[model samples]
Target: MSIELGVLVAIAGLVISYLAYQLTHIKEVKTDSQENAEVKAELGYIRRGVDDIKIDLRANEKQISQMGERITRVEESTKQAHRRIDQLKGGDQ
Candidate 1:
């Protein structure tokens, strides 16, 4: 009878110890408000970064458009110079 009781007590002790360990190691979930706040901050940061990128893209696009216009003007001037050279050489009109 004594040995039986000792065995039961040992088993109970082990179960209690396991439960205590689990309680200590359990992780708590973040509250919805905290999660939302973090998400909102991240989104705001990303939006600002995206806005900056859009500004840079617009500036680059304007520069590219100006360069294209300049190239067209240069081509027209080149054509005119060629016409003058051909007239000097007595080539076709």
Candidate 2:
């Protein structure tokens, strides 16, 4: 009878240890899943920011091209005015 009791106690102890191990594994898996979700969310936010920057850069490039054209037009007008002034001066002399 005493041997039977000892065997039962040992079996119960093994079952308890197995349950504890499973519970710990479940907790670790949940923690890892939560961490992975947070990482993915952060990456999504960064991707949005990069997309916004790209849009801004495109707008800036367009504005710069427009300004360059305006400057070229102004330079051509100035050269024409200078040539007219030189022609008038030569006529007066």
Candidate 3:
């Protein structure tokens, strides 16, 4: 009878210790407000970055459009110069 009681006490002690260890190691859960705040902060940063990219993209597009206009002017000038050269050659001939 004495040994049986000792065995039961030891088992109870082990179970209590395991529960204590689990409680100590349990992870804390974040509240919804905290989670939402963090998500909103991250989203704000991403939104700002996207806006910056859009500004840069618009500037790049404008520059590319200006370059195309310049190229068209240059081509017209080159064609005129070629025609003048051909006239000079015919006169020389």
lDDT of 2 by residue, 1-93 (tens): 999999999999999999999999999999999999999999999999999999999999999999999999999999999999999999999
Per-model C-alpha lDDT, please? 0.91, 1.00, 0.92
Inter-residue clash pairs, candidate 3: none
Candidate 2, RMSD to the unseen true structure: 1.3
Judging by TM-score, tell me the better candidate of 2 and 3. Answer: 2
Badly placed stretches (over 4 Å) of model 1 are 1-30, 91-93
**Residue-wise lDDT of candidate 3 within 13-91, one digit each (tens)?**
9999999877766532345567889999999999999999999999999999999999999999999999999999999
Count of clashing residue pairs in every prediction:
0, 0, 0
What stretches of model 2 exceed 4 Å from their correct place?
none
Evaluate residue 72 in candidate 2 and report its C-alpha lDDT on the 0 to 100 scale.
100
Clashes of 3: 0
Ranking by TM-score: 2, 3, 1
Q: Enumerate residue pairs that collide in model 1.
A: none
Q: How many residue pairs clash in model 2?
A: 0
